[model samples]
Target: MWTTTPHIAALSVPTTDPSNTKCYTTKHLITGNRTSTQSEQQLPTYSNASQRSILLATARVIIFNPDNGLQATLNALIDQGSEATIVSEHVVQSLHLTRTSIAGVGQGLSLADPQYYRPKRVDLIIGVDLMAQIILPGIKVGAPNEPIAQNTQLGWILSGRTQPPREATHVVCHQAVLDTESLLKQFCEVESVPERRLNTAEDVWCETFFQQTHKRQPTGRYMVRLPLKTIFDPSMTLGKSHQIALNRYLQLERRLTKTPEAWQRYSDGIKEYFKLNQLAPATTSERQSTTVSDSQHHCSSCVLPHHAVYKEESLSTKLRIVFDASANTSNGRSLNDILCVGPTLQNDMSAVILNWRQYRYAFTADIQRMYRCIDVHPEDSEYQRI
Candidate 1:
């Protein structure tokens, strides 16, 4: 059953660090707390009294502590005016801390300060820092007195002034104070002489993988394996894609038929691929075994769908075959999805330009079929099967 009320859904995304990301998982149940936790704070020990009342903007949200895989539902204050986001100390204390290390932060930094202790009633305050990330673009206002609906990554939140409470006598005013000194210190840390750039765990693994797997062939061409993530193996999830590749090939043929010049270039390119030993026919046994049905029995070879790309501006080799590694298999994931994209090894463009400026003379040379120069490792070639 469904209701006509406007709503937004929080989409679940796969992540290596689920605790850190705002992703939803069904492993744990998260329910909102409707009962409010009320508290009163007086600046000068209740010297002033008020007779009017105002509505406070609060939304029920599930707060997750990725550090300990603990999640709790609480009513959060939606303060768009505040610059910093803060959670109650009690909320942090309530969540179990099994691990000492935070996801991406180094061990030395301490975020806790006794000076900024918030009252228990204010369970969570979603200030500008987090609001910028979670708040989605759209606002729905119904009638003149209804609560305004605001969209966020978590879901739709209902806020704004509703019907005033008849029993309300005191006007509750809340003030948010930001620590400028701490913020300035953080800003100075970012702006000061920079420390050595630290590579993430994934980046280190990618570098190690390249060093271990990449090799130079007798012909001076480099053969490298696709840097695939270990957690999500394509062989396990990849579905029957032979038909998909075949359909894409047929579509390419139809598209090429419209332009005979492009068709001839494509045909010549295929012939060149065979002539240069870049492409080869599968053996008889392989052809017999590698089929749509055979895929279910074992880890089948991936069939990469390819098409012609025409770059008219290029002085040499205007046409090329572009393999679509990102083409979706029967399963939602693609080859690109599982691959850990290795870091760029080349120098920056700015550095190259600076070097060029220092040199008395400079000339440019182009490598013939530069894109095809790198050879895929033999074991990894199945992933690039066309």
Candidate 2:
């Protein structure tokens, strides 16, 4: 039969007699969206003309040792007729379960033959020994002392894995209990990568630091700066992403420059953005525009290429300029060609969602022109000059 548990979808096949049962659980890795009607056509079916099946029980058990405070969830294939509980190799490493080796893989073992195992890719076979650690709830069930026959078909799933000759281990199943209250503990935390923080004082420093520069220095006007070139050594080639961005920018520029209506809207957006942030030097005249090489930044006075993405659902102009700071130079150095001796920071979505779940009524707040408003150091401005 077919049915689903909280964590898995499973099918149970009953033999000629209904008293004994065998169950197998499988989880799909499908992404995107589809309806049941569409999925029914794509789902695989057994070819042996197997007898009709019924869904059976599945155990989503969380195993742990209370004394040492170790815990993890195990989605097991519940086979009552099978002699003992088996654990997959991934479980041992992922959940840190303890195990011991008893036998080596051989011709008689599951997925042991190179010809069969190569195609099947069977890495770990959980034997009866792991029954010692299969933490079940209060349900009591009979355990058979039957030994697994050689050359039996077996399958297993892990979070994810790669590399052949799968590494596996067998944990001792102490006892299967109905619940984990006495043995397992649960906890959660957020892991955000470190990122650059804006210097609060530097936010307003330009109006404060007005030295008479050798050139382009007007006493009263605030100095606009070019952001510093990122010092980075790219270990990877741009592949097709750079070309895609370049094409996108070219398309955006072509439409904006040729279509007066499109150009008017785009220019209007730029004007408003510049007016609000006071960042535009002089409403970029044709004289200020510079041509850049498609392959690299060869323009004597390069302006960072720009691009836009449209949101059809929105009425406001979603037009935005892309700052290709990572574009490679003739020497193969992009803005980020150097390394920052610091930890990176990024928000942890899981933790954010967890914290958000605790509240009811909520609202989102955003800063307008957040990145454009940040000021860079004066000495490093030449590198960012367009």
User: In terms of lDDT, which candidate is strongest?
Assistant: 1
As a whole number from 0 to 100, the lDDT of residue 202 in candidate 2 is: 32
How do the residues 136-251 of candidate 2 rate in per-residue lDDT, one tens digit apiece? 33432322321122212222211111223435888876875565653343221124433445644432332233232223334332333321123122332222122333344556
Please report how far candidate 2 places residue 258 from its true position, in Å.
5.0
Cα TM-score per model: 0.45, 0.31
The per-model lDDT (C-alpha) reads 0.55, 0.35
After superposition, which runs of candidate 1 have C-alpha atoms over 4 Å from their true positions?
1-197, 230-236, 283-300
lDDT of 1 at 91: 69
Off by over 4 Å in 2: 1-252, 257-259, 273-302, 315-317, 339-342
Residue 341, candidate 1: alpha-carbon lDDT? 52
For TM-score, the strongest prediction is 1
- Candidate 1 local lDDT, 1-386, one digit each (tens): 21111111111122476333221111111111110666343121011125322233455678787877889976566677766656655667888633232232111111111211122255666778888788899899876655677787866766544454355489899999999999999999865644445678877888898799878889787777666663445354455455566677778888999999999999897667657666644322223434454445332345556678888898778897665666666765555555665555556565677789998999998666654566676545555556
